[model samples]
Target: MKLACIENIRRQKQHVERYKRQLARHRSGEDISLKSQKTFRKPKQEKHLKSFQVYKDVLFDEFLDKSKKLQKLTNQILKVLSQVWESPK
Candidate 1:
């Protein structure tokens, strides 16, 4: 009976130590994974930001072109109106 009790205690100790080591390994592995994730995301974030700026530039150029076209059309209409008004009998 005493030997059985002693063996049970030993088994419990071994189990606790094994669990502790496994927990530590899991924590360290998580830290390594997070560090690598940050390293990987940094460059992707910069590239996304860079592309956003390029997209903004292209959108601005399109808006500017359309604005100039509208301005030109307005000027042509005003010139035609002026010519019609000046042709008095």
Candidate 2:
């Protein structure tokens, strides 16, 4: 029973020592060095082509499709005019 009491006192002393060390660290501001909130990622690089060229190509394709549609509409209007009204040469 006496040995058990001694062991308990020893364990309590160790716990107090640990708690004091932790307190000292907190007072010294050494325990606040936590992981950073912001993470760094590698910047992506274009491997195949330049960004401007890619965008220009996309815009050119769009313009070409629009021009084709306008040409078809104009042709239909001219055909209708030719059939309904005679054109003077």
By lDDT, who's the top model here? 1
Question: What TM-score, to 2 decimals, does candidate 2 have?
Answer: 0.35
Error of 1 at 43 (Å): 29
Off by over 4 Å in 1: 1-58
Cα lDDT of model 1 overall?
0.82
lDDT of 1 by residue, 40-82 (tens): 4466788899999888777777899999999999999999999
lDDT by residue for model 2 over 62-86, one digit each (tens)? 8999999999999999999998788
Ten-residue segment with the worst summed lDDT in candidate 1?
30-39
Root-mean-square deviation of Cα positions for candidate 1 versus the true structure, in angstroms: 13.4
